[model samples]
Target: MRVLVAPDKFAGTLTAVEAAEAIAAGWRRHAPDDELDLAPMSDGGPGFVDVLHATLGGELLVTTVEGPHGEEVPATVLHVGDVAYVESAQAIGRHLVTEGGAEFATTVGAGELLLAALGTGATTVIVGLGGSGTNDGGAGLLDALGAVADAGQLDGGPVLFAGLSSVDLAPARAKVAGVRLVAATDVDNPLTGLFGATKTYGPQKGIAEDRLYEVDGWLEQLAEATDRRTSLVKGAGAAGGLGHALLCLGAVREPGIALVAEAVGLASRARAADLVVTGEGAFDFSSRSGKVPYGVAEIAAEALRPCIAMAGQVLVGSREMRALGVENAYSLVDLVGEQRAFEDPVGSLQALGERVARQWSRE
Candidate 1:
């Protein structure tokens, strides 16, 4: 049997690459003769470029950029000649931002990276817009790309909703002339309101519940300052409104998982495979929103292949998994307690793989 192993990052624990390798190792132990095809995935988040680099030929360039809170962090950009792939997490990711850093997490670092990519002569720039730790709606990014604004307005420096005087995109346009900017994202949250950035993702970034409204209002101000619509556009709230900024600059939005899958030729491979196994950190309702596992499972469904899902914890019920075209879903935590699952994710995931093989290898 041919088994295709694909998974997303386990969030704060293991990357998709690490998890895929571990799963393959365990599957080999259980079914040594079975053919294994490992493909790791990302949803425009932390490991976007790395996952794409796993299959797509590219030169991964490393550089230092300003962190969300002013510290310098090492970031990577994938250059496939005239096209550059930049993942926002490398600059202002959740892992690099502390609780306090979230309060003032700026996209300046990400902006610098984008500016540098512009300088590399890349005609097409693809930015993975997820796993952010900012609430400033890409003000810092605009500033870094030559937009004229108050320094405080660009630095997550407590510029209130009413304080932002203006935003000029002319300079930004002049800098990125003839370049196509694509904002890669999973979610389609609008820029403001209940389904928007602050209400949906602010708490995760350390914003006090009471202050969510205020932070959201600031983003509204940002939209007004730039003469852009606050709501209605999908993905405008992604990466703390970085999506809005990219859209403001004429960047087109694309579903991240599908884009990566196309880059990796996942559909053809899945069609040729007998079985598909995809997983993530948590398999919940959110997975339906164009996440890696859901996308992979859809490919399997289209190919008439049985797809199984594995996760650290399966929050969604079996019915939901079935609806997503997943034949079976398993959780590492259910097999080996939470402590063991977190303490040794690789081992637990490996065990899950072995268990999955046992349940399906002979079928």
Candidate 2:
């Protein structure tokens, strides 16, 4: 039996690579003769560069950039040939905002990371956008790239954007004149309104529920100060309006998972495997979106292979799981208690993998 183990990062617990290794370890314990192919994936979030570096074998350039709160943070840029990959989450991810709300988080560090990628002499820069802890409409990013604002420093987040008089993106635009910029995003939400950055993702980054509209209005105001049209573009809301900033600079938007799948040759791998296993932190209806599990399952279906999932938690019904092209889904929280799953995620997932192998592996 041959199994293809591919999974996205399990949120706060394990990275996709770690998750794949854990599953493979347990599967090997149960079915020692079975072949296991580990292919970790990402959807332009935290593990974007790591996964790409693993499969693409790029030059990982380490650098220091501003964190969401203006502190210096370590970041890496994956340089492969003439293309560079930058993960926005490395600078402004939700996990980095330890003390403040989204209202004060900045995307300035992301801009710095982009500059680093550009410094690599890469003709193409792909900015992976998701897991952000900001809602500043990319003001900080523009500032980092030399965009000037009349009234604000641009690194203080959305609250400061409310006082902006005007913004000049010309200088910043000139910086990336000949380079091709790509916004690899997970969501297609615009920069402002109900589905916008502040409203949809602000709460998770610590925006008070009552202040959603207020912060959203600030981003709207920032957009008006700059380019309102770019604010309405799909994926503009990604990474707390960082996508809008990238769009303003003439970036093309593409699904992160799709980019990753193509880079990893996922379709060909699925066709070679007898069974495909994919997963994430939670297996829910939202998995139907451009997530790793759904994307992998689709490829598995096209290859006429059975696809199953192993997640931290299974929040969707069996029918919905099947609709996503997964034969079945396993959950660490379901097999072991939630405490145990969180306490020792690697071991818990390895155990879950062994159990799933018993049912799926023909050994």
Candidate 3:
């Protein structure tokens, strides 16, 4: 039987490619005759550069860029002809920030990465904006790009910065006069509101409640200064308002997973596969709302193929997934203890794969 193994990163443990390898290893151990296809996946967040580079045959360009805390960090981007694929999280990601200093962190490195990619003569830059550590609303990014923010008259302006508080963007905007920026995001939230960047994701990024309002106010001010008046802009709140920043800089926002999936020919793969397996770190009610697995499952379902999901944890039962066209669901945590399972992630993945294979073989 033919089986396609496609999974997202295990979050702080295994990358999507590594997870696929582990599952393949286990499946091979249990069913040597089975044909296994591995397609590592992402939702346009971290691991985006690697996956796109591997799939699209791009040159990986590595450079030293500023980190969130004003330190130099090794960051990479993918160059495919005139198009450059950039993952914003790599330069200023949540994983790079420490607890105490994350509050004042910025996306300076992200801007540097963009500049580096643009310096390669790549006309179009595709930035995967998520998993960021900063709440600076891309002020540092604009600064690195030579845009000066005007903090005084933000409330009403034709060229508004999305989140600059005391910062300015006039100088930064002057540097890149003709570059097009495209932001890929999974979220659809405004830069300021109840569902704004700070209120929705600040706590996870280590920002306190008292400071949430402060950040929101800053975002409003920046929006006004940049002359960007579209608060209803979809994905404006993504990647700690990186989306908003991109919007202010004339960037177009698109659903990240769909764009990447299309570029990777995900639908074709699903159509040709006898069975498809896709998953992420967790599967819950949220998984049904345009996540990676949900997107893959939709394609698989349309092709009349059965799609199964194997996650680190399954918060929603099989019944919920059935409505979403998932044939079955499996959780690594359910089969093995969470702590023990992650200790040897490969081993645990292989064991889980073997069990799943055995069950499929019986049918």
Per-model TM-score versus the true fold: 0.96, 0.98, 0.91
Candidate achieving the largest lDDT? 2
For every candidate structure, what is the RMSD over all alpha carbons to the true structure, in angstroms?
A: 1.6, 1.1, 3.7
Winner by TM-score between candidate 2 and candidate 1 = 2
Error of 1 at 90 (Å): 0.9
- Per-residue lDDT tens digits for candidate 2, residues 271-311, read 99999999999999899878989999988999999999999
Task: For each of the candidates, give the backbone clash count.
Answer: 0, 0, 24
Indicate the residue-level lDDT of 70 in model 1: 88
Q: Could you give candidate 3's per-residue lDDT for residues 64-138 as a string of tens digits? A: 998887678998989998899889999988988888454568787888998888887888889998788777667
**lDDT of all predictions, in order shown?**
0.86, 0.91, 0.78
The alpha-carbon deviation from the true structure for residue 105 of candidate 2, after best TM-score superposition, in angstroms, is: 1.4
Candidate 2, run of 10 with poorest lDDT:
97-106
lDDT tens digits, residue span 1-363, model 1:
899998999997899999899899988888999898989998899899999888787888888999888899999889987999999989988877788556578888988889877777899999998999887788778878888764236666334335676777899878788999999999999988899888999899888898888778778778778756734489989998888878888889999999888888889889878999999999887888889988999988888999999999999787887888888889999999999999999999999999989988963
Clashing pairs in 2: none
